[model samples]
Target: MAPVSALSRLPTGAKLFITLSIALLLLALIAIGATLQTGRLADSEVRARLRIAANESARNIAIELSGDINALRVAVAALRGDPADAPSCARAQGVFAQQATIGTRFSIVDRSGRLLCGVPLDTRIPDDRDDPVDVRILNHRGLIVTVAAPGGAPIARVVFPTAFLARLVGSGSRAMPLGTALIDEDHSLELTSIPGQGPLERTETVQTDLGLGGLQLRTSIRSAPITSPFLVALLLPLLMWAAAAGLSWFIVDRLLIRPLRLLRASVAAYTPGEVIDPGKLGPLPAQEIRELGDTFRAISRTVALHEAGLADAVVRQTKLTREVHHRVKNNLQVISSLINFHARGAPSADATAAYASIQRRVDALAVVHRNHFAEMEENRGLNLRSVIGELASNIRATAPEGAGSLHIALDVDPFLVNQDVAVAVAFLVTETIELAMTCDPAAQIRVAVKPGDEEKRAKLRVVSRAFVESETLTHLLSTRYGRVMEGLSRQLRTPLHHDPMTGAYEIAFPVMGRD
Candidate 1:
């Protein structure tokens, strides 16, 4: 059988855990992707809203600053009417005050850095600058716009309060939470403070043509609220997925895997001739599992019934076989008695010897049947040592009167042969011993059954002077005895070997046991 792998040996729970873990990992990846996509959408939406707010704030700042610049230009034109004398500060201030809105102030200075006109007598003119129109931010006076002539000399300066610019930038209602700031791009200065206080997450800038120097508006927003919704969206599904996976594992383990494990255990413990009991498993969680267990129990019961029937049939056959062998053995004994009775009445010695020979052969067969019957329970085969030994003893006891002093020696090894082989071995031994006694009345017959050259084989050898090529033995071979021995050897499936020099008759036969 092939060996099972380590992975295959793992329990159902461990395999389920691995499967669930892989699913959870995929779900985690999906959650992360969803969270990233949600954050991108929020950022895009916030960016769009911030862009609109910044654009709107920049436009308002630009429009307010444009009006202030145009008013200053009108004041400058009014002053340019007289070129001979410097415009009177009182007259210039009067023209600017009429056009200027509340919280607005103006200062007019000549090419020599002397104050030419002012709304207030103590109004300070800003330093000379090059741009025709420039905007600056002051901490106390909001935005300052300086107008200079084509000669690169400042002609006038307008001061717009920071409160007025803040009002212009804060004109409209916002769709989202945000902060706004008006910046002087030239100086990198903030004209108005951003609306909200703490650190901002997103910021956008919009440039405006204020007819002065560089000026722009910045809009910013915090993303804490957006982040809260994104986290909820990402976590909600993941939690649900985990719960569902856990529930699935629990259901499968209880309803399917656990009941199957129990059924497997019961099957492993099953033995032949015993009916399997599905009720040992108690109540199963699933109907399918219950049905499977019941099916297995039914199959096991059917097999057990068949096995019982086969066992009973085998017992009956064994009894019948043994009875047949017993009857045959009894009949052989009766025939031996009849032969004894007939030989007792024979008048000639030759006839008496013939009867003795027939009795010996009959006894040999009887011995084989007895041994075979004895070993039938195991069917291992008859013991060669016992068969040959008993045969040798019987031949010596029934020796002719003159050959009564015959010395027959038995040296046999313990080996087993089937009934057929045992019969052949017995007959061969009986013939050789009888021939030896007939040729030499006092012959020392040596019978040996020993391990053969090949495995599971044994050599039955009869060593005596009768096997030699003597005239008496040759004359005896002309009778039916020599042919009978040959026939027995053939039955054993091996040629009988006679060594003239050693005076031994040998033939090999198969044995049940190893050498």
Candidate 2:
């Protein structure tokens, strides 16, 4: 016999292994392909854009504020008194207009840092009145530059619109592809092109002096997944597939394939006639295969035990049957001998004939019993061939004197029947031969037992040429003797039929063990 490999025994291990291997490989390929094709981060371009935008806006603001301070100095020099009392600070107003600036609010303040004219009286100016140009942010007002007189002390402050800063910051076309934010030195947002609530991937920041003393302009270029649909679509399922395949392989190997291998090993070690100790197998993984192993191990142990005891049980049963048949034969022999002794003391010829007939029937039963023990060692059941052959001899021995020795011939087939049914068949054949004998003392009876109809039934025929006219046998068959033969036929579940022309009595019945 060829040795079985451990892998071959696992019902689905190979298929599952191949399937998982292919799946994981495919997922890896997809991830690799997507990674190779995917675009890289926009950090370099974003940093440059941010730096340029911040620098350009800062430079523009510084130049404009410097120019505004020089112009405001001329206005301060042209005035002789507080501009708050002047109907028109006409010269300063004209200079502001000449700058062609929009959304500019101007205020004149004294050396004391009190707002004097040209703007809201409630406006408070910064205390740094000595500087030529000082940029400051007031609470309600947005961005302002404070300018002192070019020759002296009186100062003028100009506040610019938020749009002015926006135009300068957003001046470059590619400044921020996704978005940009301008943060003040105070960490407050000065301007933004997109919201800041989402997760942000920020590039290198750009900081440039706004010519506003310590206040600097900081620009950061940032983006989010919401800004890139292609990246999201390309990478999401790839990551998911990789994760799923990894998790699936781990679970299938641990819970399914590993346990399957263990089960295969356990089963391969099993031998048919030897009981397997369930304890020899260790705890299996928690899976359906574990339940299957437990069931098979239990069944194998139970079947092995049954196989071990079966031979002994057969020997004991056969011995008991042989012993029972032996005692039955002895008892039948005793009965046959008693009938013979009575035959000798019969008072008349008719009484002697009656005792002899009784003796013949007892002898027939004794022959059946004898055959059962004779074939006991080969004990399956009675072989009909051997049993019928023996009965022909017994019938010839018990024939009455002066009737010339009975000549019986058999044409029998090889078949087996159990003890009880074999006895019935034996008796039926005996009674048949006896009836033929009574019909003709000089008769040669031919008994045939052969397979019929696919071996499911057996046909038995008793024919005698001596009873050609059928006068005596026909009369005997219509009498009480016929009823006894009929009863035997019914017990065998087969009916007897005689053909008048051939002088053959035929019966067909089912045989046990023929199948």
Candidate 3:
């Protein structure tokens, strides 16, 4: 046989606990995974917003520079139409002044790098004018644009201060602080100061080219802080998972487990012929459990009622049977009295002997009836020992004058049998003893009842010297007595064995109380 496992031996409550715990653990893991995924998405969104800000800033700066370059082209056209003199420079400066905005200035410079008009800038002009317009950044301080004439000679130049680029980048919002800078990669200079304050906890940076002489726009944002409320949000599902597990377990234990346990205990304590009370279980939580208890209680009540009915029927039957036996016994006694009265007035000895024989057979039946009635109350069958003993005595007492010294020895074992069996045994024993007495008046009869070869069966033996085959005994058995004993033996459902050698008549009888 296989050994029982520890987990299998555990009660329902313990198993439920383990199952709920595993469910909680799985839920916790899923909740944690969701929280982490949410964080990643949030980070991606922050980086996307930063990239958008950088691209926007770069676009705005390019638009501003394009407008200034267009104005520089006008100044260059004015300078190209006249000689390289003070008057022409004056007119070009006048054209430049009309297009200039705050923190911006322009100058017309010759091919030799001579300042002809307007504000002078400490910057070199590229001699190679293959490009019509040239844009430059100077130490992150200002943006310089130079436009060449038709002969590929420098004509005009414009300088916009770094402060002008700062206004274009704009300021950061209170929720998500941003830092913006215009960086000149070639010169390694930051044209605009970053806008924001304090050390950035989580920062995302995006750089976009401004398309003006290696100038690039850098945008950085400080992500929102991870507050207590945010952390609470992340753990909310886990908290809910735990709460749900606890609530579910409580519901199961209260509604299912606990009620079932109580019901089982009540059933275990129930006795036969008793009803199980549903009231002992108190109030149940779920409807199903309540219905189960009600069903069991109803079945118990039904069984108890059935047992009560059967008991009443058995009692009534016993009383009726005993009354019948009592009446039969009275009738037999009356018959015996009538026979005795007739025997006293008999004209011959044989006539009186025939009356005695008839009286003895009637007495045997009466003895069987009396024993059967006595055993009816106990429901156990009649005891052959008592029935046969009383029967033998009655026979000896009512013996004829010829058999006045009749000696009958009883060696019967105590065994029970039904009424039919008792009646047959009584009649057979009476017949055998009388036959032996009639054949030989001084015959010694020994009646023995012993256990048979089979279970719940007994062998009844009547041993006597008179039972041996003889002319006198044969003459007596040739009468109705032989057929009467054969009928009694057939009623017992076994053949009567006559042992000529031992002079014993034996027959097997069924015993009672096999159950």
Candidate 4:
């Protein structure tokens, strides 16, 4: 393999290297992005899974709790129906328990929030938060425990900080309605390994001195699915580029470069356009090389037959070169036109803006094509600095005097990009320059594309050294409206972010071309 810095200097090698590098970089970036996204998704999925587990566990516990409480209720009702026990000042006590093998402890609270009943010795809890309850315990901890009471006012609070209870319950505490914790409610924390978060909302109650009573029921779930499709979207092209580069390099180097070098060097002794002798050269190693040598020899004989054919040859080559370039330009224009058509048809402002950004990138390639003359073998790896500077100049030329003075400074190497990506970045620079200038009449824009941490990573930065105040910028950066910034992000395949203090809007997009 060649050093990266050296690859850009070779004729066809540079373009190939650049194309591969970009593809690899994009693949790396996408892989990284996908990995990151997947990691996040997996974490979220784990959380959701845990939450579901917790909820299911809690729901089962709730059912068991209801059964235990109901059994106690039946006992109380049976005793009460006896009339003598019904009016007794006994304040009936019953234990809450479950039949599942998973460990569980039960506790009961009276109408006045007093602890009444059978329970494990370990737990120490308030029978009721509303009126004041008491509890008598022996062993406190067990698996799959539950606490419930018939009287609604007296809430049940279960505290499981013990090692045994902690092991039994994966994570998360179960709370009953009208529960009290010496503190405020209405708080949210994103923790892994906890679920239920079911249809529960927070409602506060003013209890006479029993601290603050609040019921925090499971509300709507805030969990998101773990797939980041955008990261995948950015990766597909990178793989194609990699496969293309690998195959092209093998073919071009063996078939075109090396053999041609041997032919030109060996045939140098003969006159320019002379009738070459095939046997004069050694037997070619490969069939293709031998065939090319023979073809060159035949060409020499033909050239010798008609010396005047050289003029016609030059004319034909020139015509073909011009035709090829023209067709490429027209092809680029068609792509740009298509992008524009889609952009105009976009239904929302954000969608339109995204399409507009896409069109701009296409336009940039179109500009490059416009500047390239016929006969230029490859426009890949075109100087980014020159293109950027020109793009900035173009924005200034089209805008007002104050905006037109905007200067662009580029600090990036002449990395390779295909006509497609190059055009897009060009438009990005143009759009950034124009927008930045418009934002602040005296703004100076600095656009830089630099290699990032890994080979598949690149950073395209457009920053303005200007002062403009707009609340819309904050809205643009908001998570609620992040999708609205389609233009900047679509071009970069990254994200658009704005820092309030510096008033800098940075859009980092992934480009399929690399170092």
Candidate 5:
């Protein structure tokens, strides 16, 4: 069987119905059990009452029989000194004349069981005393009480008719639902209120002591079942169950089910991204449902306000970004112009070349700044080949008088880097070209960029056909220019390699992606 706790899975209405049903069922069972128990108690009470009635009847009979025996003893005492002859017997009969009745005779028997004297005498009785009994109940006749005379005269027997015992038990009353019998010690039925009413269902018996021995008065009562009475009593519990069920349904519907249904309907109709009106749900008697509706309305209002604020912030941030990039582009153009003017005013060839190189580096910055503003939305830094092409053009534009034929060839892979790192790379290329011009001034320069050992790193190679190999140039690279390039390499977090045999200058560095 499933565990009882699975009942919790039932709906609210079903749970209420089942709970009330179980409670009523138990109450009905208890009522039936108690009613059956009461029936048993009633049966017991009837048995006790019947036994008491039989005992009382036997006691009354004993009292009356005792009185009769006393009267016979008195008569025998009166004849104590008289002779046991004809006149004596006649006198004895005259003495007991007042006590003669039907089923009760004043008879005197001698020591040999002979009838000595009698009132209304009949000679049919034999002079035999073969069997003796103290209290003898005769079949359909009477109750017999035999006793010996007080002075050892013949035995005197008092016979009380069956009508007397019937009167003692009140057999005619409707309250007495019993059949009564007077029985001997051997359980032989001598006299009964109902002579042939089959066997009794329930019997109670009491033993009574007469002068000779004892007799049993057995009374039996029929069974009185509780089924009919229990059925009659069940109407009250049925009515109780009806009342409880009605009240429970009323309370559950009013306080719980109806309100919950309303709440569910309101929730299903709700739309997201919109403020909900608390008034839509109106009111509910249940406190928790009312509070839940209030909470939902508050949440919708808060979300709407937060979304409005976020939109405003995005608009302000975009405007500020465009203004900053515009100012930066204008400033870079002015700096490039100033560097060109300074180069034209130089007095010597070496000083003019130096100024032109500085102007080229400035122009590289201006080109990068323009590209940055153009692709700001892409945010992928600067394209490596585009920056290199801008740097090569700037170098060719600033070439000295006869060196205008100097050509820079480019073979570069596509990649991206942030503004700062791209500028650092341009400066490194500018320095390599200046170093090539210092060695042969007329050599062609080749610059190329490609993927490095890992995806996030890239190598830039600058090769030149310069054979000058000036010792002073080596000294400048080691002492002065070495520090600037090494510092740039440290900022880019990569090492720079210089190969004099191939005139190959290479730097490998981690590239930062913008998107």
Candidate 6:
């Protein structure tokens, strides 16, 4: 892949668009995840409610059938306890026959288990108690459910969820089947739809003994599954994602991308030297793009003014060059005349000393004039080579060389310095070299010119090799030379590096860029 920085340099609008698109995609993914989790939770909750409802229905049916059978068993016992031919016994049988459906039918058996009177009086039931259950079940019960059958008096058996309950069982497609059975004192099918068996059944015998043989209660179990009802179950997350994408597009269009496009257009038309009046554009509110437009306008105004001022300054500088040249001619003539007067008169050694002293001052003044004249001729600055070489030549001739020859060399990127800086350097070099020569004439002194290393961070070095060995010179460098060098470095927007190793002084400063 290309470097991220290379791609970043593409227009800001493109960057913003890509970023916005990515943000929207991430938002969509998050929404979908949240939705799915919510749907799962919702499903669980709904299923729990359904399960509870199903259990309630099943339990209610069991209780109703059991209660009815209990009532009938009490009535039958009252009739049997009376005389066998008694009108009450016959009346009880008549009442039973009137209410007899297969669900309510019952048989009264003698102590030998022989049928006495009722529907299925001659029929036999399956011996499920002796038959092993094929599938194991989690719960078990004997005959009665929610209550016990009265011990041995009158046996009653009942099945729950008659056809009537099934008719009202469900609301639309959510219906589930639930059935149950209970036995009481009256041994009969107290609540049942018909005589045949249903496809699904759960039968359990309550282990507690009844007054008669064991009785069974059969029930069907059904439940709804559980899960979360709010987020994913409703598909709400998809709607939110679609809405967020629309918002992202709207935001990028009105607030971010369009302004950047306008800025790009303005930058395309910009050029350095040519005059432009961005003022033709009107003022705007202080948003970033508007502020940028205002900055461009100000920059155009400043650049135009600068170009005109530079052209005018060029012509004025040409005129000043000629005037400086005339002044230099006058100063040289005066110095020449003074030297001639001194030569014509021969006095004592003291007199000669005084004359030489006067000549030295004149030479100093002449160096100053030469530098000024050079600056004027250049129009904008002083030539570095000319100024340095001239100063070095002057120092070799007059600065009381004690015991040695002086070596001076200079190097650079072949450039010039500002007039003021160049003149100061020229004077500084001359004074420093003179000070060195006065110390020891026999000393091997070297001044070399070389380009500064860009990686070195220091610009230039004016090295005086032997002077650094002197404690006095070290003090002068620290207190005086250091301050002067630092001031000049600041003015030039650079740094000076000074290293004094034994007798050597290597001073380096940051280089000014060549014009």
lDDT (Cα atoms) of all candidates against the true structure: 0.75, 0.68, 0.80, 0.51, 0.69, 0.48
Worst 10 residues of 2 by lDDT: 175-184
Ranking by lDDT: 3, 1, 5, 2, 4, 6
Error of 3 at 316 (Å): 5.0
Report the C-alpha lDDT of model 2 over 1-515, residue by residue, as the tens digit. 23346546655645565566677768766765665454344445555666776677677666776677776766666542545545447656776674436566787767775666567434566464566666666552466667667554577778766666566556344524323333344434354454444563434556776656666666655532334565555666666765666677678777877776767786788777765554465666675776787688788878888877897798888889778877777888888888889889999988887887787777767766776777667667777888788777767777877567678888888777777777778778878777777777878899998887656678888898754656787788788468888888888788888787788878887776641
- Among all windows of 10 consecutive residues in model 1, the one with the lowest summed lDDT is 185-194
lDDT for model 2: 0.68
TM-score between model 1 and native: 0.66
Flag regions of model 4 displaced more than 4 Å.
Answer: 1-321, 324-366, 371-375, 378-380, 401-407, 465-469, 472-488, 505-515
Which portions of model 6 miss their true places by more than 4 Å? 1-71, 78-104, 110-112, 119-151, 158-252, 255-257, 260-306, 318-326, 337-356, 368-515
Residue-wise C-alpha lDDT for candidate 5, range 348-457, written one tens digit per residue: 88788778877877887787887777778867678878888888887787877767668899998778888888888988888778777766667888999888888788
Q: Tens-digit lDDT track for model 1 on 311-418?
A: 999999988988898899999999999999999999999999999999999999998888888888877888888888788778877889999788888889889888
How close to the true structure is residue 397 of candidate 3, measured as C-alpha lDDT? 90
Candidate 5: which stretches are off by over 4 Å?
1-307, 467-473, 513-515
lDDT per residue as tens, model 4, 101-154: 233434344455354443424444333343322222223222222333334422
| Candidate 1, residue 230: lDDT | 62
TM-score of each: 0.66, 0.51, 0.56, 0.30, 0.48, 0.43
Model 1 lDDT at residue 337? 94
Worst 10 residues of 4 by lDDT: 207-216
> Regarding TM-score, does 4 or 5 come out ahead?
5
Best by lDDT: 3
> Which is the leading candidate under TM-score?
1
Better of 1 and 3 by TM-score: 1
